[model samples]
Target chain A: MMSAKQADRLATAGLYAVAGVILALLAGLLGYVFVKGFPMLSWQFITSPPQIFKGGGGVGPQLFNSFYLLVLTLVFSLPVALGAGIYLAEYAKDNWLTRSIRISVEVLSSLPSIVVGLFGFLFFVIYMGWGFSIISGALALSVFNLPLLVRVVEQSIQSVPRTQREAGWALGFSKWETITNIVLPAALPGLITGIILAAGRVFGEAAALIYTAGMSTPALDFTDWNPLSPVSPLNPFRPAETMAVHIWKINGEGIMPDASAISDGAAALLILSILLFNLSARFVGRFVFKKMSAS
Target chain B: MQTVAVPSRVLSSQTHVTALTGPELTRPKLETDRLSVFYGDHQAVSDVCLTFKKNTVTALIGPSGCGKSTFLRALNRMNDSIEGCRMAGEIRYDGIELQSRQVNVLEVRKQIGMVFQRPVPFAKSIYKNVAYGPIRHGVKKKKELDRIVEDSLRKAALWDEVKDFLHQSALRLSGGQQQRLCIARALAMQPDVLLLDEPASALDPVSTAKIEELIGQLKKEITIIIVTHNMQQARRISDETAYFYMGRMVEHGPTEQIFSNPRSEQTRQYISGQIG
Candidate 1:
């Protein structure tokens, strides 16, 4: 049999090898994407609209649509997810109903985004008559977003030590008061990290948006800032195409002469934005945790 | 080893029971009758009846899992927060039954605060930690909160060390200082009773001595109930001592009587380190 020291060394080397393989894979993927797409990126390429039969097209509306859809998705999802999470973490008893709810959330979170897209298409797009619009895309995204958010919130709240709650109760604070003041503040870091990560997912989403938000953008008047105006970019009822959807569309059936170039630039921009989101999430989470915990 | 003789105010068995229950003229500050605490089906504390007089310290000494901590927690209804935990007993404060539905638990907790074995200071500034209790109770004025914070910290014997940087996070303080901050947090509510569960066990010797000193000073106004594993701790700080064994109070009397002249065989064995 191998000696304990030999076993330890072997285990350490094996772990390092596995870690190195993962790191190399990630680096390789990122490098390939950046190398192919970075050359196509330019100010004009980003700001101009897509061409039907021409060479020079920008992703300005699609980029705006990505962020707008993300904001709208959060607006639809965060409150309901937060409430459900708090209930599951703090108040729910170990009963059948709560157990089933937990199981359902788990199953729902594991479901494919495409399935959620179809459901949103059927329910929000056609049934609710919010056809091919940002609103429908947002509602569909919420279906995909809610379970993950609820789990994040529940785990974050549970991460707080039991002693903290006891301290609150010892001070004669009500249950709601304790949860709001002590628990939420302590869980803020995790909540912020979870939210921004979800935002990144929503920002990069294409499949759900294709079915619900439509594959084309309506002509938007740049000066028309009114949300109620049909021609306004801010109008939720208007068809909006996100950057990811644009990339997918151009690659699949584009008539533009520079479709491949535009796709490469959009893909690069999308990856960069997601990377930015992840980095910011880490920075903000750490900053808030430090500020709140003072350690 | 030089040992000094401590004068024993040891009372007879009859007189000791009478003393614990209190005389008609001096009503007990708090009393628990047939207090049995259970976590689900497991009984942790069984039929513990005790009386606490005002302006005095009573220490519950026992081995691990002897229900000393459970009994202490039950006084403030802290056990209510634990899942599957329940209590069957009457806890009276100032002649009012606290266990009754008529009594508001929040008000009881306000009047009776507890300090835990490990200090639990909120992840906030020292000043904010102390002011949190009073703010919830409607002491919202800036000046009043400031005054209350200072007064509570002073009472907890933490003001001298933390006064200069009260705005600093309580988490940054030493373990001893954080414990004191927790005490100060509870004291801000101006509670009549203070429950301490091994408040110094997690601290160093010097911090423990500071906590013991603080406890001695605090008993002048607050009815303090402490659960300690250290027999010496119970001897040094408490006016009354109750020895618990296997979820039962084996004996209780003046600290001197219980220590030097115990009535029960188990109490004597436990005291002598022969059995725990």
Candidate 2:
């Protein structure tokens, strides 16, 4: 029995309240990160490797390792994720087998990151005997990312109009060709967004990497650059320390004396990297989606 | 609605004669013999027999749910994509049984294309949209693709409007131009049969006229089967017309005969704007 004005006021109030809360939370987190860590963010702190029992610790090696791992994880996950998504969205009939796979993916998506870490530890670390390697950790992270990528990509593919598929077929294109030429390109934005989000999740991950990728920092060695060579510096099987692990190691074990400052610096750097990644992804997405919609 | 009963002797004898004659009538580009389609257990089209002569326009006219669209889709085996939908009897193209197990749906589609009620341009540049089919069938040379795109667009009569913006997205075109772009995309594949399921249904008057004109011109090059609710359109563009009622072919013959002197009372009522 509320009046029209009253109902409108109530709806407006509810929306404003929700927006306020979201804005407040984001502002609070950003403010805290900047305030606590800005003082310690020096050139040397950014460029130099962490030294044990020292006041000043930089994340130079950790930053490099994060990028390397991100690239490797994308390489492993992109093709498989996109391929599985295409099959599910375009080829797979809505039969019992497809239904089961969909259910399994839903289950995997909901499973906690820590559970994935535990599984990685059991399989990659203990069973496979790939003790504390970057490759192993990347593989584990790729598994974590796979289900997400598939769901996002499948949804994107589904969002593409059936008319487009019909148009392609009408043009005498095969199913595979139609998918590649018409459907995939149209769904590219959603696919890229999924990948970027997965990359962010992988970049920020600590618990899983701690188990699979070991906590030992490596010295820069240009000569041993082969990624697959067991003895090479780039070999993922070689123990590598990332930023998240560096922060955890510093704060928990007190390997670095001024743990508070170093942890804050690492946290700020992690936040910055994630923000940068997301911003770039958004920029690319805007361009691609605009072009797609225009076409 | 007036119901004139046809003697069973004529019906039975014609069916028997067609069955015995085999493929002697120099199989038209597309032919459907006693073709019926079912959705689950419910029949959508029943005992519909028709033939589309090569390089001629054949129109299927009916009220809503009479299965004209369903029959058009059956020609290209597009109905196979629908769940719980099945077809009975035979559809032959150039003396080959289309429903045979060995018939590749993809290859069949390559020869027989479709244009839907609404224009469905791919979310790609004008150039890419036309080039998509050609590229897929192993036309790798960019120059060749460019030539095909131009030729197809020209054939579709869209080249004059969109030639300068070939790189622009297809979606930016006006409705009529987009429909023409879709026609060009189909023409690029050089399909022998073009099935249009109310190609002008969603268009404005001008666009509809353009599409109707395109259909008239296209019939000279490829066999066309169109389903339309618009009687004027059927009369204007079709060489042959098949009128359907309650899933049955009421009458089918030369367009002039069906429109001017339909033997069936159902077709007469339908054309005179009485009972649907």
Candidate 3:
């Protein structure tokens, strides 16, 4: 019922208001993180192990542990996720079974991360009796990552043109051969992007690792590399501490004087790791996928 | 019209004057005994029986929704991929039943390749797109694959235009080039029967002429079946023509007869520009 000029003015003001709020929120978060955490970033704070009273305890061990978990989770989850995705997208017919499985996957992807952590704790820690070790943590992270990986890979494979599949078939190739040679290669870029994003999620996870990997730091033992041994050096059965868990523990106990410092260091490291993963994913897509498509 | 001097044998005939018939035809390389296609409850094609002679171009001409493309797709079992689409009756290629459940659809597709109405080149390099099938079927040697890629491109009449940029992405090509690349991809399998579903309907006039010329040359090496709505194209490129109306083949014979002396009233009206 307003005049045309008045209504137009109101609409423009509403659009600007929404944009302003979003920008303000983003800027505020970045400013707070930088101002609170930048002062604690130092060589000693990065390299030294944790101490009960010292303000600048190093995070070297925690950083190493995070890397270990990230690599192991990716190694275990990538193949299985890609395989399941290819099967669902390329081989499976659109029947009741496939439809149900697809719906289940969509549901799993949206479930809370904390819930996934709880399941990991039950299955890998208590049931398997692995205790607080890197193995248990990796298994937990793998479970959390599997559904996401599958969904991404499935979508990428499905995005490929039907004609490409038909072209392969016309060349006398079987379904398996066509998927392996044609479909998978074409979908690699999107698959890698999903893996990188999943890795970021795993690197930042803390709640799930709490019950599975524990907060206790172990002494370095290079000779205990035997994977079969229950107390092996690399075994997740031994208590392991990651950066996110360390931050949580230090902050909760209120014992460490530089709790803010530790949190800042952990947040920065997490951000850096995610950034690196995304950059590398982009690099791979640009060079490798481009070459593959043109080769 | 002026009547020429009749031969002595025709003059000696007592009963009536007989029109001259076309040349005798050979056995068909691919034949359908009684093909019927259904999409769930609705029937798409009904009791279509036809034969395609070896190394000859056959055209299935029809109006929209007349099931010409459906029949063409059935030749390669491409229709099998569609949900709720079912086919009854027998389609045989070289005396081998293509519709039997036991028969491998993959093998049938390999022997009888298909080109769709639209150009569909994979998002891969021109060379790789051409080499994709050869490699999957256990062609391990790189040198052999390279040779096959070149040969197929040459056969598709796209070799000279694409030879220098073999490593370029297939998507970077023009529409006409992309369609030709699709043809090359199909020919790489060395299929005996080539099924084209309005291959040139999506291209420009120049591109259409190029495809028509390619079809003429391909008949020397493979049996060709084309579905087209263009009657002039049917008369120009096809040796035999089948006019489909309302999911049924109203008339089928030599191209000259189907165009000039159709046997059925429906076909006569259709070809004379009186009805669809």
Cα-based lDDT at residue A84, candidate 2: 85
Q: What is the Cα-based lDDT of residue B267 in candidate 3? A: 90
Candidate 3 CAPRI grade: acceptable
The regions of model 3 sitting more than 4 angstroms off are A2-13, A42-47, A91-103, A221-236, B1-25, B272-276
- Model 1 Cα shift for residue B108 (angstroms): 0.6
A best-first ranking of the candidates according to their lDDT comes to 1, 2, 3
For candidate 3, lDDT tens digit of each residue in B1-276?
222232321122322322222223444678887799999998899999998889989999988899988888888888877779999887866555576545667777877888888898877899988887767657889899999999999998999999999998998998888999999988987788899989998999998998999999999999999999899999999999999988887788999988988889889888888877
C-alpha TM-scores of all predictions: 0.93, 0.90, 0.88
| Candidate with maximal lDDT | 1
- What lDDT does model 3 reach? 0.81
Rate residue A67 of model 3 by lDDT: 84
lDDT of 2 at A197: 84
lDDT of 2 by residue, B72-140 (tens): 888888888778999998987765667766566877787788888888887778988788788888899
Candidates ranked by DockQ: 3, 1, 2
Give the higher-TM-score candidate: 2 or 3. Answer: 2
Candidate 1 C-alpha error for residue A206, in Å = 1.3
